[model samples]
Target chain A: MTNSIRAEWTKFRTVRGWVIGLLTAIPLTVLIGLLGPLGSSFDCAGPNGAQCRGNTPPIGPDGTPVFDTFYFVHRTLTGDGSVTARVGALRDAEPWAKAGLLLKEGTTSGSRYAAVLLTGGHGVRMQYDFTEDIAGPSPDEDRQWLRLTREGTTLTGETSSDGRRWSTVGTVRLDFGERVELGMFVSSPQHLETSNTFGGRLDRGAPTVATTSFDQVRTTGAAAEDWRGTAVGIDPAREHEVGFTDDGGDLTITGTGDIAPIPASAGSLGKTAENALVGAFAGLVAVLVVAALFATSEYRRGIIRTSFTANPRRGQLLAAKAVVVGGLSFVVGAVSSALALPLVERAELAEGFFQHPTTWLTELRLVLGTGLLFAVAAVLAVALGMFLRRGALTVTAVVVGVVLPYLLAVASVLPTGPAEVLVTVTPAAAFAIQQSVEEYPQVAASYTPADGYFPLSPTGGLVVLCGYAAVAVVLAAIATRRRDA
Target chain B: MSALHAEWTKAWTVPGTAWLLAGVVTLTPLLGVLAASSMAEGGDPARTSLLGVTLGQAAVVGLAVATVSGEYGTGMIRTTLTAVPRRLAVLRAKAFLVCMLTVAGGTAAVGASVAAGDALLPEGLSIAQGPVLRAAVGSVLYLALVGLLGVGVAALVRDAATAVGLVLGLLFLTPIVASLVSDPDWRERLLEWSPMTAGLAVQATVDLGSQPIGPWQGLGVLAAWASAALLAGAAALRLRDAS
Candidate 1:
């Protein structure tokens, strides 16, 4: 065993490709890590605030709010506009609502009002235009109301009666990194000398017949945590207005500002470590592929007979190859992880490092854990290669084993419930270990607290990933021991 | 003609080549269809349809690596050398065979993907658009070029696994590293030059203005990498002993 280990180490050091492959991981990890934070900076403020400044408002040049930035509201109508009442009459009345104009008795022109509320630069708003007249006497009759709210790029709209019970109207998305706004205005078509009335009777002796109320307007920042047990409201617009109520410890909202960047977070560090392990495992596939070719190359060249003459023990030869390949992979994984750590740490610190000691421990565990995964992969690869004895078959099988499950996970042909579980069980499950987010939608169903939905627990996801690795290793080992070299 | 026939027989007789070709055929289109379907369900067709190409290129690289590495692994290069004696001919013949196979396989994969995308895409995605067509066709060519890179790496490394690793690392690692890097300028430059990133530039349909490298130019960059690898491999093959 010692002789094989020493021999393997010698071979590994001699191999130019292994050296290059191992060294390559350092720059690669650093590069990908840095890009995540550098892409864009988020401003939690909208157009009319100090955060915006000379910076282009999250809206377009035409003053339309960009979809992802904030909820925009313009109470005033643009172009040719007139407010036609549905269930109410317009009257020249004294001001009733704060931050808006009022219509009084005998008012000829429509009342116009516009207000833009940027949800502290987080979340979206739904737009509501109450001007579209409802033709029927029924209160449930369809009417145009503009309401907008955003989560990521997704925007939802809703309408309400008395600002409480809301009905969903529609949803849409604008572009990323753009501001959004809502506009409201009321206008009458009648000449200035003539008075137009909607709703109740208009008399000079009494107050005007029509009145409209807009209240309970609110927006809350969408939680950045994974959607699990959170109620996802159908009304995309009013969803922002819905607040969180704690349930079991299962569903929690760790706001964006509170959560550390990926490298700094304990969870994120674990994830990166897992990623390194997976990468090392991937590299082990390469080692196995090469080793199989090396072993078989001798056979195909009729040199195996000579090799056996020199060293009669077939197991010893296999052992030497396995040790060499596995050792190389271990060194490669460790060196790569070690080299990558400082760079990733520096980048994370640039973003703001987590001060907790637990975070550092998680990061350390992640790096060591990744090294183990690579070693395992190397051993599995060599064993498979030795068992198969045919270079082409071994390489094909190894490649398929490594790559196929990942492909299956991403392909959504399976039924949603089963597919979600299956996807989480495959490479996606393994990869999910790299995520800092407590709940990942790719692995499980997510819900908002205001909306009702159940998702798999994070522990469940980890078990599934471990299951895949165990199954793969066992299969490879079985195939290795049973097959002739 | 006999040499071509012999080479053809040699290439096909090996189970690895057949399996790899089959993988290229089935996996690429299947991935494309799946991606398209997923995207269509989510209301974004283009990103979904082209997803197969992301993974398919890796397979193409694998296939290309196997072309040269298989012969080296089994010690068949010496037999071919004895038959043809001219080292350059063997290299040329292998390159030609692999390129033709890759192009044909890549075309099938890309075509199936595009067809699947067209069938599965939501109402808004139109296959008739010129730029979209270019992206689709360019994707096929990109796979072919990646295959060439694989072959070159195989020749240089002379070990199937090492060659595959080196090529995959070259193709995949740079982009990953570039992504991890904190500096935008370095990342942008890496994205422009990284073989996989540059090759994948052909897939950009939506925001042409924002891409680090232009579509055609990205393809050209990959071609350069392939050419350089092949040249280096050919040189190595010329200087090295058959064993």
Candidate 2:
């Protein structure tokens, strides 16, 4: 088996076109990655038409980009304090709109915070930081009493239908300074609407504001300063009006913008690390072509008969060929991906595009998974070539089955749901291996494949592609043994 | 004239040619049903109904590539060149035949896809409308042009798998890479020149102003690609020795 494999490798290396083709994939991947960021500029329009530079979103406690804009009505609390308010009504609210009491270390964007809020659609939720959410007792939308308390470093959230009986929703530990802001807040994220069109999708976002009326507001262990309204992280360019009116404790707040993890959706300025690897698809096409020709050319030249006679074991010969092609492709994918990641990220960063943070472990998976993706796809192509023995048909079947689905799904052509279904089911599922970001359920963002969010987990997607490759290899082996080479 | 006649006979003699032509017809509407059913009630009905052309074009490309590359694979090209020494005439004949067959299959496929769209979509299709009529006719022209492009590529490469791969990479990869560009100017420039994106713009019955290129101009871009490829193949055929 080793000898056969060595012989196959020698044959592959000897072919000038095959060697050149495999080499071509590396440069193609890197070139696309490097050039993808070119000609794209980021210039934010500051208030009064001034150019805003270095306006990247604030980083959360976990180092993720977060949406930290909301209307805060608060007063300083000395220590071990609690705030309670009855959310009387929520008007013109988007589904994910929030209205309730919050306790935070400061009024700064992305500061540590905890809240028990009544959502426009979901009844009540206890959320902390930017990524954590716990459901409250009721699913009711209006007239709910919400409370938050702090004892030393421990924070607790409770909800009540009336002012009399209460239920503890959830609890967590968060250390704050000697004084903290405790008050009522309101936020409504941008409203998103997707319309399906021929050959593409149209994603439209309009700014939406939520008005929440709070009454019977009470504070404990607080300073004597009067309540103040601050528009934390609000963008004046978006024409978001965030303010509050305190009519003798009958407070009303109207705000546009959310306090949650940033989503990879339409109308978002945040990009993922894998955005720089868009050129990987181009390299994949080049590699698959070379792999297809590697097997079909042997049959086209009648060299397979000589190979079968020399080996005497057709299955072993098939395995040897698979090893040679798959191994070469794996190296090509891994090396190119590793080289492309840093260069593309640097270029995009220079252009003022802030990439969502990713750990080194996730980056490592991305690089290796790309290599495995190329390896398995090459094996699948080689197997299909052997089984069909028609070069044109085999190339078409694999390319059409793999690349076309990805194009349709990620090119903004299909709607989000159907596009998600396409990536999940097709061999294109393997593209998920390139995703370097995670989706947070607490954030109501468009989780489409086009937005760098895939339906399947990275490992699961690779497994699906491997499943296809394995089936093709087994079938090819059976055909090779049964047929007269 | 004899070259045209001889090429037609050679093409029809192969059973694969008939099956591939049938694939163009069947696969076109089969995907149209899936695509049209997935669409929500807003965009151009004519364009949505004709989405099957994207997949069906693969069959057209396959049939076209086989017409030229199949002969080279079997060493039959030398025999044909001996019988008719004019190589350019042989290529022209093959290109003409591929276009004719693709146009016939494309028309049938587009008709069935439109019917499927009418049945599946909320906004029914009517061919009597100006844009709808243009989309139907332009789609058939688009398929023919793609077939011409495939034949030219196959002649230049002289290998079926490599040629199909190159042509498909050109057809499908451009728009995908283009969409990833964050710069709207570059994205529009890439789409304006892309064969598939530009050619398919002819199908848009609504939102014409928003398209990067107009219908006639987009088809012209594809025609430019097809002609350039054909001319390059002619040059290669004249320069290279026949194996």
Candidate 3:
């Protein structure tokens, strides 16, 4: 077995053109990754006629980009306190407008918090830590009572139609000190409108402000000082858009911006990590040519008969070939992807675009998953070469099967539904390995594959492509045994 | 003239040529049906119907590459070159034959695709319509130019698999990579420069202004790619020794 493997490796390295073809994948990936960012630039007018950089959304407790701007009217609370508010009317509300009572550690953005809120469309919801959401029962006639209580480190959110009776909306544990900011708050996310046209998706978003009138506001274990109103994460340019008016006990707070995780598709100025990996397709094509020719050229020259004479076991020879091809491709993919990510990010940064925050674990997964994707695709190409015993047909079949489906699904005139289905069913699903941004159910965004939100998780997508490669290898092995080489 | 006759005979004699042409015809409409049926509300039915051309172009590539590279594989090119002695004429003959067959297959395939669209999609697609007719004829021309491009690349690269891979990358990958650009002007420039994206722009019937490139102009860009590839192939044929 080792002999056959060594022979296969020797044969691959000996061919000048094939070696050059495989190596070309690395530079092609790096070059395209670097050049794609050069063409894209972003600029916005800042305060006092200065140029504004891209959005720098706060990083949440889970280390994801989050919108943390809202209006807060608060008083300091000691240990084990609760805030209750009657949401009388929410004016000029978007569907995701929030008029709620919140308990937070401080007035800082990205701080740990919990809230029970009345949403413009969803009635009542309890959201905590930017990423968690729980729906409560429907409100009657836009009127609801929201309450948040702190018991030790545990936070409980409850909602009621009347101020007297309350049902638990959600319970979550957030570690905080004895003193915290308990408040009445209002927030509305940017209104995003997406319309599908002939070729692509069109997205337009505008800042929205929602005003909530809160009466009968009460807090337990609270300080006696007057309630302070502040707008967290408000841009100075848009400061006038957020404010609170208090007339005796009735408080009206109007706020712009959201308090949820940034959706991968909208309401953020950052590009996903996969935007730098667009060169993968170019690299994959180069590796595919070499992988196909590695097997088919031997048949073209009638060298397979000589190979079989030495081995006498065709399956081992096929395995050896697969190992060599898969290993080379994996190395090329991993190295190129790892090198391209930072370089492309730097170039995009120079052009005023920021990368959405992702954990070190997800970044590692992307690098290794991309390597596995390329390895499997190359193995599939070699298997296809053995199965068909034709060079042009093998390369064409794999490219059309793999790359064409991806281009049609993500870049062409296909609609989102069909495009998602195309990626899910076809080998092109492997590209999902590069999806660095995740879909958040709490955020309303165009979560389509074209926007880098794949239907399948990263590992699930790699498994689908591996299934194709495995089946092809089995068929190729059977054909090799049955046919006279 | 004898080179043309000899090339014609050689083309008909190969069994794979017939199957490849059949693939061009059948696969085009088959995928066209899938694309047309998958479309949602408010799209150009004419363009969606012609989406099958994207798949059919693969078959066109196969036929054209096989026509050039198969001879090299079998060592038959040396024999033909000795007989004809004029290598350029032989290449011209091969190019002519490839284009002729691709047009025939492309026309039938595109007609079936449009007919299937008329049945599967909403109204506003017919052979009598001006833009639809232009799209239909332009698709046939597009397939022919793809064939010429394939023959040229195959002649230059000489290896069948490498040539197919190169041509397919040029046809499919450019538009995909182009779509990744976030700059509107850059994206438009990239689209205008891509052979498949520019040429396929002729399919649009509903919104002409929104298109990256105009119909005839897009086809002309593809024609430029084809001619340049042919010129390179001619240079390679003139410079290199026949194996």
Candidate 4:
């Protein structure tokens, strides 16, 4: 068994292509992980905005300075009422920019609210309490009808490609009352983007007011006949402040900052782990290829025949390969992630954002768990190769199984339920292990994919992935005994 | 014509061709049903209905690449060429046969997948819808073109493993790398040009304006990629020794 292990190890090291693939994993991980945060710390662009801003944690009583500010065309909705209008145009924008309609508890920027918004380029979103950006329709053209209806505490957001037909974007039970404010709004966050990797400079484009026009307004059920509006969260020294005008026919609003649910103050590092762990996917890809090729390449070259002749014990041979591939993948995943975390932390902190400090044990668990994820994925790939005996089939199947779930779950366009379902069922369930940000069912903050929560707990998710690997390995073992090489 | 028959026979005789094609048939609808079943009420019905095409294309690529590269692996390409001394003709024959098989499999797979989607989805989604019809038809062509891409890459590399990796990487990874890019316009451009992004864009029923490329245009981009790949494969086949 030892000799077989050593021989297999020799073969693994001998493959130059595999070695290069493994070596390249580190830099790809670094590039993806470290580079994502380059723009996370950027200050707002344009005149009078030369200040440390936008990076402030929205966990404030008044919310973050860059966000939680918007100009509104408002009216009081005492009961069940819907605010609907056709947005004529959205122009002159920022990346994290938005304009839409909202149902709010108070006119205060940090107030509990439900809104249907059209982002500058990111598409429509139904956001509540300043953070939970539910995927909305990517409507046809720039023209869209936005409506937010309130019945008691429940708010329903609907959009229309044309005014006659409506698609419900989403519904959320906001913590608002009967006499809540309903209005049209526009705001833009500080626009900073990472054009390149860490070596490349961040583009801090000047913040611009996203001027938007809302026409053909109609209201039903207890709406204010004499509607009033205001620039919520105005700052005396704020640059490019939100402004508005309500003509009899059309309402034009210009604003800066987001309108959603926000906590009272900067408390903990909610998204820091997600920020640090951008290397996970890149590392997983590199590891997946190398791990998959380990077993499949043997069959590809007919070297498995020679190896079987030497070992005869097929299970031992498979086991040895697993050990080798699993260990290599683990080291790759662990080292890359360990290196990535600090870079992400520095980038986050440098921008004056508070990353609620985590325990050392938590960090250690994340690093080890990330490594374990790659290792299990590697072993699974090996088993898949053995059973399938074709690199293309196995690799493709594994990718479809693992990566597809993650992609669907993260895609802002898809509904959140399928994303959660995918995470629950697929091998990507292991990603739950990397999910350090715990979603408290009680703490009704912004816990959406903008803040992600896996359906399963970390251990449970890993077990699901391990279950896949185990079943595949068992089938491969049984078949190895019965099939011809 | 005989060469085409010979290549077709060869593909049929291969160890897992039936299973591979069967896999395409079964998995397409299975994934489509699963996606549709899990879809939220507000999700794009057309895009959701044909979501299986994305997964099913991998099987098509695998089958197509294997049709060519397996011959190289087993040293049967020499016999294939000896039987048909015109190397380009043999390549073309293989290309023609693979594309036909893919299109046949693609049509069944896509048609059934959409049917499953229509069955599984809510009331608003229908195959009768214009965008859904285009998406369904375009997906078949997309699969056929992807198969050609596989055949071309396999011929160029002369190995199943490397060619599969290369094709999958080109089809899948570029979009991922492009998304990581910070420049919005550049990212959109990257998506517009990447074969997978452009090709798969055909399925989008809603939010046409936001797509990097139009549905027909996206399929055209994929078609261009397939053509370029097949031409390159033919050139490689003619220029190099049979090995």
Find the candidate with the highest lDDT and give its number.
3
Reference-based lDDT, residue B16, model 2: 78
Better of 1 and 2 by lDDT: 2
Sorting all predicted structures by DockQ, with the top scorer first, yields 2, 3, 1, 4
Cα shift from native, residue B238, model 4 (Å): 4.5
What would the per-residue lDDT of candidate 4 be over residues A25-112, giving only the tens digit for each residue?
7777777666544533333453665444433434423232214677777878787888888885565566456788887777865567
- What's the distance in Å from true for residue A83, model 1? 46
Candidate DockQ values, in order, are 0.17, 0.63, 0.59, 0.08
lDDT of 2 by residue, A1-485 (tens): 99999999999999999899888988888888777677566457766766545367877888887889888999989878888889965655787898888988798898989999988877789999898999876545468888899999989999888888989999998887788888989899889886655566677788788997999999888886789988888876554467888899899998878989887653245667777677787788888888988888888889998998898998888899899999999999999898888888888778777678888998888889899999999999999989888888888888998899888888877777778888998899998998887788777767788888899999899888998999999999999989977
Ranking by lDDT: 3, 2, 4, 1
The Cα error of candidate 4 at residue A138, in Å, is 40
TM (chain A) per model: 0.42, 0.93, 0.90, 0.57
Best by TM-score: 2
Candidate 3 lDDT over A1-485, as tens digits, reads 99999999999999999899998998888888877778765456655766653256677887777889998889999898888888865645787888899888899999988888888787788999898999888766667788899889889998887778889999988888888899988888888887775576677889989987898888888887788988898887788888998889788888888899876652235777787888888899999989999988889889999999999999999999999999999999999899888888889778776567778787788788879999999999999999998888989989998998898888846778888998999999999899988677778778887778889888889899999999999999999999999
Ranking by TM-score: 2, 3, 4, 1
lDDT of 4 at A261: 36
- Between candidates 2 and 4, the DockQ winner: 2
- What TM-score would you give candidate 2 relative to the actual structure? 0.94
Model 2 CA lDDT for position A343:
84
How badly does each model clash, as a count of residue pairs? 69, 2, 0, 13
Q: Provide the DockQ value for model 3.
A: 0.59
Name the top DockQ candidate: 2
